[model samples]
Target: MPGGDISDLDKNRVLAQWLEWQLRQVRNRIRELEVQELKDKRRAEQARAGQRWKIQPQRSNVAALLHRGDCSLYSSEMGFLDREEAIIALAEPDIEACQICKPETGLVQT
Candidate 1:
């Protein structure tokens, strides 16, 4: 009877260790999934924001020129271009050429 009881205790210890390891694996997987979900949500929000911008355009002639490759001028400093310069460049009466390109401002400003 004594030997049988010791064997049972050993079996129980092994089972408990296995269960603990499985639970840890499950918790780690859940954490990984949560991080992936947050990343996916951020990407979706960015896509939605881009779509909104497409729906409504910002008013700036420099923006339009930058959208096209006709002019090689680009702002080297980090700030919003003066509104007057944008207006003048965009309002050129004779530059009716169309070029295919995307507008890229280096950074967003508050």
Candidate 2:
């Protein structure tokens, strides 16, 4: 009203256009971020798939993977072992326990 003739009934078309442009930019950025997120998730899934519960070198195809009863095992292998076994695994000479899980600290060695 103060600038010039009423562009429309009273709608601020210029402001709407600017807002629309800003919204589009935000949406594009969101899409980029989502793609990155999906990539990270897929990468994580792939890594998980490769992760093994037992990392011991097999002497033969018939080589027995450590049993659940056996406390000693590999640091890479923990998916199957419970909390107690995890600690035991760390105690073994060959097996290195996970630092994050700290399998050895709370465990009672016998």
Candidate 3:
């Protein structure tokens, strides 16, 4: 056999090594994809499980505020703030600032 020419045994060995490397790469990619899928599934499940209630303030006060136009009720269709965050903003004195009337009285007068 010529020194430059690959023997059958040498070619077989090289082919085996190449196939092994390819399989390893494929397996690594599969594992990575599986791990990412699991993570995404866990995140989605957690989001579903941690459901939050819509903000429903005490009726009379909210009605009064709405009636007087002292406070504006954000529409559900509005994209600005979530109900929970809006409620929190309402409850917190520091966050509640009147846009039109007296800035001192944070709570909307009705």
Candidate 4:
């Protein structure tokens, strides 16, 4: 009966090791998925940032402001401007490009 007891102990040890390995595999997969999710989130943010431009209309005493799509200084919930629209906006006498985002850096004629 002692030999049978030893056999049971060995089987239990093997089972514990297998379970630990499986746990490690699951943990590793979770980490990989987390990394993938982060990358996808960043990609989506970049897509939103580069896809369009926004303008803040003139306020009481302030001129209208132009901003990059990703600019944090001013947020306009109105429709976004395309490249040509941005260029035209920059040409307006009262519209000025945002200093922080420099929305006219690429759009202005040299």
TM-score of each: 0.45, 0.40, 0.45, 0.70
Kindly report which residue pairs in candidate 1 clash with one another.
none
Task: Give model 4's TM-score versus the native structure.
Answer: 0.70
Residue pairs in steric clash, candidate 4?
Answer: none
Point out where model 4 deviates above 4 Å: 1-13, 76-78
Tens digits of per-residue lDDT for model 1 on 40-108? Answer: 997886544432211012346633332222223332222333434333444455332224323233222
Off by over 4 Å in 1: 1-6, 54-110
Report lDDT (CA) for all predictions.
Answer: 0.46, 0.54, 0.48, 0.87
> What is candidate 2's lDDT per residue for 32-75, written digit by digit as tens?
99999999997886455332233344454434343332234443
TM-score, cand. 3 vs. native: 0.45
Name the best candidate (by TM-score): 4
Query: Relative to the unseen true structure, what is the C-alpha lDDT of residue 13 in candidate 1, on a scale of 0 to 100?
Result: 96
- Candidates 3 and 4 compared: the better one by TM-score is 4
> Candidate 3, 89: how far from true, in Å?
24
**Best lDDT goes to which candidate?**
4
TM-score of 1: 0.45
* Per-residue error (Å), model 3, residue 108: 19
Model 3, span 1-110: residue lDDT tens: 68789899999999999999999999999999999999999788545422321222345443211111222332222223333444455666434333343222433345
